[model samples]
Target: MEQLIKELESRARTLRYRIVKMIGPEEKGHLGGSCSIADVVTALYFHKMRHDPKQPKLRTRDRFLLSKGHAALVQYAALAECGYFPLSELDTLKELGSRLQGHPDMMKLPGVEANTGSLGQGLSIASGMAAALKLDGLDSKVYCVVGDGEMAEGQIWEAAMAASFYKLDNLVAILDRNGLQATGRIQERFNTNPVREKWESFGWHVLEIDGHDFAQIIEALDTADQVQGKPVMIIANTVKGKGIPFAEGVASFHNGTMTQEQFARACQLLEAEECEGR
Candidate 1:
């Protein structure tokens, strides 16, 4: 277990570095949100999800959707690290003719399950996929990550109701409660506080944990498997711009740019983390 945690931690750092490298100084991408979900995405791809980079379309493989699609960089990093595609492809992110775009395009990318980034739509899409999988008698599970700010969408609640109504136990929704959204604190904007009670009231099984804690993440996912009658929701508490000293918890970094010096500093911090883990 200790070794597994170490491996996952190391993988998260690599993913973060790649994310920072992909969003160059000229174009500010979704840095804060992407960094916030790095640990969760790492855990899902490396430790939890049953997937194959070699056979992405293989039946019975687990599905992952980034509902808050602007955070596609993290998923792209994970996919590249997992061999879904060559790492060199990451260098052309958002470039014309590149599969790595600003948002995930299922048609263009091999590992991306849905075209996301508009926010509030991923849950509905995931619910439909979950229902379809169950209808076909497939045991595969569908996992969707939604941002706290995205929960303001009425469609999310509708999907939540539908999941519980159909008892889609194979559906697990992870809430990235990173507090701040693109503009500012979610509470100051579209507050979605008391998320736990809201989810419980929605008739779903809910678990809360430190998003960066590998052990807690692994345990919560395992427990979600044991839950039977309803879908599971893991409310992961995270920090925006995690792992970078200057960016951590700073809302401006949500889609902030990074100069060459800042990028170097980010790399240094991630490398330091890797060394400490070693």
Candidate 2:
């Protein structure tokens, strides 16, 4: 278990590094939210989720949907690292004709479960997928990553009700409660406080955790697997732009570009942290 934690921690760092590179210097991207959920994403793709890069459409594989789709860079990085496609394709991110786009497109990417980025809808889609998998008598689980900011949408609550009403135990939604959204703090923008109570009231099983902690993340996922009659919601408290010192908890970097010097510094900091972990 200790070695597994170390490996997952390293993968999270690598995912953050790739995210920084994908945005690059002076290239606008969803750096903050992407980095915020890097640990959860790493735990999913590299540790918890059952998937296959060689056979992405395998019926038995678990499904992951990034509800906060602007953070598609993290998922893209994972897919590339998992060998779903060539790693070099990452450089073409957001380029015209590239499979990688600002938002996830299932038609373009092999491992992406849905075309997301229109916040609040991915959860609904995941609920539907979970229902279908259940009907098919498949044990495959559906995992969705949602943003606290996106919780303002009525559709999300509706999906929550439906998933619980149907007892979609095979579904798990991880809420990236980073507090900040694209413009500013979520409470200042559209407060979604008391998140845990809200989900619990909706009949979903809830687990709260520090999003960046690998041990808690893995343990929560394992717990979700054991839940029986209700869908699980893991409310992960995280800092926006978690890894980069200057950007952490800063809203401006939500979808902002970095200067050349900032980019170099970001890389340096990430490298130093990675080395220290080893």
Candidate 3:
């Protein structure tokens, strides 16, 4: 368990620097939100998920959908780290003719199960996967990470209800509650507080934790797996751009550009974190 935590931490640190290095001037990135969920992605890809890098389409493997597709950098970093593709290809993010698009594409990418963007849709797709797995009698699980801002969509709730109604315990939804949306805080734009009670009302098991805390995340995931006759939802309270000192906990940095000096600073912080883990 200690080794898993250390491995996840090292991956999270490396992911941060890769994100920064990948984001140059006018770099076309989603730094704030992506960085905020790096730990969660790291934990999932490296420690939690059961997958084969050589055979991404393995039927019994766990499933993950980046519902908040704007944070493609997070998924890209994880994919690279997990050997879905070469890490060097990340340098071409958002570049024309590059396989790495701004959003995930299942057909184009090996590990990506679905093409996700335009919030509130991933849950429904996940529900379908869960339902099919149940029918096929496959012991597989589906995990979807949605943004707090994306919770405002009515479709999300509908999917939530359907998952509960069908008793899709193998389906897990994680909400990255970093407080801000594209324009403002979720409270200001469309308050979705009391998120726990709301999911409970829909007959789903709900757990909330600090999104960046590895221990808490693992605990919640364990609890999520124990839930039966219902689906599970984890509301992970996170800071936008978590590890970067200059960018952490702010909405503006979510999609802003970083200067070369700033990138170097970010790299330093990430490198220090890796060295500490060592």
> Using Cα atoms with residue i matched to residue i, what is each candidate's TM-score against the true structure?
0.98, 0.98, 0.97
Q: CA shift at 116, candidate 3, in angstroms?
A: 0.7
Each candidate: what lDDT?
0.93, 0.95, 0.88
Best by TM-score: 2
Specify the poorest-scoring 10-residue window by lDDT in model 1. Answer: 21-30
Q: Indicate which candidate wins on lDDT.
A: 2
Candidate 3 per-residue lDDT, tens place, 82-128, comes to 89899999998878988788888887778888888978898999999
**Candidate 1 structure lDDT:** 0.93
Error of 3 at 74 (Å): 0.8
Alpha-carbon RMSD, candidate 2: 0.8
Model 2 misplaced stretches (Cα beyond 4 Å): none
Superior candidate under lDDT, 2 versus 3:
2
Name the Cα RMSD for model 1: 1.0
**Sorted on lDDT, highest at the top, how do the candidates line up?**
2, 1, 3
lDDT of each residue in 81-102, candidate 2, tens digit only: 9999999999999999999989
Q: What would the per-residue lDDT of candidate 1 be over residues 67-99, giving only the tens digit for each residue?
A: 999999999999999999999999999999999
Residue 256's C-alpha lDDT in candidate 2? 89
